[model samples]
Target: MPLAIVHQSYGRFGGAERVALAHFEQLRRMNIDATLFWSGLVTPGWQTRLKGYDIRTIPSTLPTPRNLATMIRFLRELSRYDSIIIHHHVDPLLALYLARNLGERTIWYSGSMFELAWEKWITGEDYRSISQTVKQTGQEYYGKTLSSLVLSNNVFDQTVRLARTVDIHAVRRYSKIVANSKFLSRFLKRIYKLNDTPPVVYPGPDPMLEQLSSKDFTGEGDYMLAVSPLIPLKNVDGMIQAASKVPSARLVVVGEGQDRVSLEERAGMLQVPLFLKGNCHSEEELAMLYSQCMFHIHLSLYEPFGLTPVEAGLFKKASIVTDHGGPPEIIVDGETGFIVNPRDYGMIAKRMKELLSSPELRHEMGQKARKRVLEKFTLERSAKQLLAEVES
Candidate 1:
C-alpha cells in the first residue's frame, strides 16, 4: 500500500516524533512505499535526524485564524496516498478536516486527545475538567460558544472546542483509531464516548538504541536519569522533591522546556545535585545515559505512553514511573520497576532508595525489564502491527 504518515511537527524530537519516524522507516523497509508529511518547524538538529527520509512540510495556520487555503493544500497533497495515518491531533482543525475528507483511508494513531490532556497541561487546570464538563453538559452547551472564545485567545482548550463545534466527531470520521498504550485506549473510549476500546500499538525504543546496547559502556552510576521535557506536567518539581529526600542521589535531566530555570532554582533551594542537559538530540548520548544510570525515573503527569522507560528497558535498566497514566502500563509494578503515585514524593523517594541500596535488586529488575522490552516492545513488532492494522 502507498502509505502516508501525518505528524503535526518536529518542534522537538520527542517520543511522538520518534515513533512517527520509526513507523515510516519500518514500513519502507517492509517494501511498502511510504512518505511522511509534517507541518511546522523541523529543527536543524531534527533535520539531521531525518536526513534520508521522504519527508515533506505543509503550510499550516497552527496559531493563526483557520484558513481554507491550508485545508485545500493538505487535501491536494494527502489525497494521493492509498492510506493515511495521523499521529496526534495537535492541529485539530486540520486533523478534523482531513479526517472528514479522507475518512475511509485515514487511521488516527492517537497518543491522546488535545483538549483532554494537553489543554489541561497547558492551562494547568484540574485534570479532565473539560472532558467532564462536556460529558455532563453535552457538546451543545460547551461547543456553541467556542468560536468567540477561540478568537479571543489562542489557548488550546478553545481551539479544540472550536474545531469540534464544526462537528464534534473528530475520531468518528477516521476509518480506525488506534492508541499507543492500553491506558490511552481506555482514555480515548471514555472521553470520545466510543462503545468499543481502540486497539493499542505500543511505540518502541529507538532502533538505534538496540544497536548501541552492544557497545562497551561503563558501570551504573549513583544518579538516576530522566529523559523528559523540563515542563510542569512532567513533574520535574516532584523529581527534585523526591531527590531531596534520598541522600547522595543525583538527578540528571535530558530535554529542555520553559521550566528549566524554575527546576534549577528548586533544586538549588533544596540542595539537590541536579544536572539539566538540554535536549540530547543524539540517540547514542541518550542510550549511554540509560546504560550508566542506576535506574531511570519518569514521573510525568498524564503521559500517554512513556517511551523513556521502554528505552531504559532496552539498556537493561529498570524505571520508576508514575501510576497516573501510560507509564504504569509500561512498567510491571515491583517487577520491571515500581509504579508510584506521581504526587507522593515520599513513595517515589522510597522506591529510589530501595534501588540505590541494592545493586542485586536493580540488576534483577533490569534483566526483567530488558526481557519485557524484547518480548513486547520493539520497533519491528510495532511496525508490523501498524502495517497489519492499516492493511486490514
Candidate 2:
C-alpha cells in the first residue's frame, strides 16, 4: 500500500515547504509510493517542478473554512492510502476522525511548539475570519456545533492548555509522532506530559545552496548581509542599529515582509547605509550577495533552525547570529560564526567591526562553519534520520 502525506500547501516557498520537498524527493528516490495532499494556490513553476510526484489538491484554503467539511472530504479521499502522515501544526481532530474511520495506524509529524501556539498568538485574527465563514456555512462535521464554536477564544485557550490531552488522543489513534528537533521533542514532552519520546528529524538545507556554492564569489565584499523576512521578531531594526555604528560597512537586507516600510524609515533615522533588497528568490543572486558580504547576520528572537548561517558558511562567509533559540546550535562561537545577545546592538557592531578588520579570521571561521554543516546538517542526514524513524 502507498504512503499518503497530507500537509498544508507549499505556501510562499519558505522553510517548511523545503523540508516537505526534501522528504518527497527522498521517498521518490527510495521507490516508495508517496502522495502529497495539500490545499492552496500552487504556482505553475512549482506544479511543473513536481510533475513526477503524485499530488492531490484539497478543495479548501489553508485554515480552511468549514474545516469539518474539508476534513470529511479529506478523510474520504485519504482512505485509499494504507498509511497517512500529517506534517506540522494541522488540526489533529481531523486525524482523530480519520483514525476513527480508517483504523488507528496513521503517522503524525510535528514541527514545533511555536506553530501549535501560532494561531492563538499571531494568527488569531485570521482564525476568527475562517471561523466566521465556517459558522455561516452551518457545518457540524467534527462532532461540534459549528467550526466557529471550536475556534472561540475560550475554546482556543482550552485547546492550548489541553495540548497534552490532544496528543494522548493522537497517540491512541496514530501510529507515530515525528518531531523535527530534540529541542522541540523536549518541548512536546513537557507540554503533553508524555512518557513516549517523539522522533527528532532535522530539516535540510536549501537545494539552492548546492548550486550557489558551485560558483565563485563575484560581488564586492564591503557590505554585511541579513537575509530574512522583515518582521518584528527577526530583529532587522537591531541589525540596522548595529550597522550604524560601523559606518563604513553597508547592511544589505534580503526578503520582504509587513515591516519593510517601517524598517526603511528606522534605517533612515539611524542614518545607516541599509539597502532593502526585497525578495532575492534567485539562488544565484543570494549566493552572489553571500559570497561578497563581509558576513551574514541573523538576530531572530527565536528560530527553530536557521538555514542562512549554513548557506553563508558554504560561501566561506562568517555569520553573526543571536544567542537565543536554534542559531546557537547552528553557529560555533568565534569558530564558524559569532553569537551575540539579541538586545545588545553595541556589542554586535563591535563584533562586526572586529570581523571586518580581520580577513584571515573571517576565512578561518567561514571554513569552520562549512565543515560543521557538512559534518552534521545535510539533507541526506535529515532524510535518513526521518526514514529510519518512519521505518522504526
Query: Which prediction has the highest TM-score against the true structure?
Result: 1
Model 1 clash pairs are: none
Q: How does candidate 2 score on lDDT?
A: 0.70
Overall lDDT per candidate, in order of appearance: 0.78, 0.70
Q: What is the lDDT of residue 102 in candidate 1?
A: 88
TM-score for candidate 2, please give it.
Answer: 0.80
1-392: candidate 1 lDDT, tens digit per residue: 67888886424557887777777777788888999887654545557867887888755543334646665776878898999999764456666777678888989888777654335434466333323222322222224354334434357466555555643465777888899889889877876778789999998876878889767898777789999887677888999999899999899999887678889999999999999988786777877898999999999766788899999998889899988788887789999999999999999999999999999999999999999999999999999998888888
Candidate 2: worst 10 consecutive residues by lDDT? Answer: 129-138
lDDT of 2 by residue, 229-284 (tens): 77666789899888888868788998776677888998899888888998665557
Q: Candidates' TM-scores?
A: 0.87, 0.80
Off by over 4 Å in 2: 9-11, 41-45, 61-70, 91-103, 114-174
Task: Report the number of clashing residue pairs per model.
Answer: 0, 0
Number of backbone clashes in candidate 2: 0
